[model samples]
Target: MAEEEKPFICFKNGWNMKIEPRNRKGWLYLSLWMLALLPIVFTFTWLMNRELSTAQSAAFITGFTLVMIGWGFAMSRWMKVRSEVIDMNLMIDFMREREAQKKRGRR
Candidate 1:
């Protein structure tokens, strides 16, 4: 069964502490995900400078860029999915409120 929820966004709701990511939303996660991958760039440069042969440097950097880019794309998709869930939750609340009002009017 779905759990009952108190009013959202108010400090009174116990969920306020846990649902914080939904409050700030996507920009933060996207930025953090990108920042998280940035260390890979430096690590790649270090490896190219130290371990890889001159001929391998270009290929290594290219592959690393491609992998990080792919990871960023996946993260973008993940953020979108999470945002959609938040939207759906809001939509369901609105619909349920409307239904409750209709029921009250009939009584």
Candidate 2:
């Protein structure tokens, strides 16, 4: 039997999805560090006009991964879902076009 088709918006179904959400759990750890550090580093220096310290400038680096939390999974999931939907739609259109051409040829 053919595989059942997934719902169009179901990223959790993992059909044609490059990475599972389970595989990316480590990102949460990274994001935690980032969330803690970004505010301390950027707030006093860039936003507040505080002078940069060799250490303050460097403190920002540790939080880089945490800041990524807001975007990473959401963006990757969006991209994967979009790519699969586009591909499925393209396949459907191509098959319809082929069928139309075959009917025309028969006339």
Off by over 4 Å in 1: 1-27, 84-107
Full-model lDDT, candidate 1: 0.61
Angstrom error of the Cα, residue 53, model 1: value is 3.3
Writing each residue's lDDT as its tens digit, candidate 1 over 2-100 gives 953322221122233122233443446656876988788788877777866767987887889898888867865565445423444566789999999
lDDT of 2 by residue, 1-107 (tens): 99643323323322554432232333454456458666655654563365667776566654554555655666555545533234455567799999999999999
**lDDT score of residue 72 within candidate 2:** 69
Q: In terms of TM-score, which candidate is strongest?
A: 1
Measured against the true structure, the TM-scores of the candidates, in listed sequence, are 0.45, 0.31
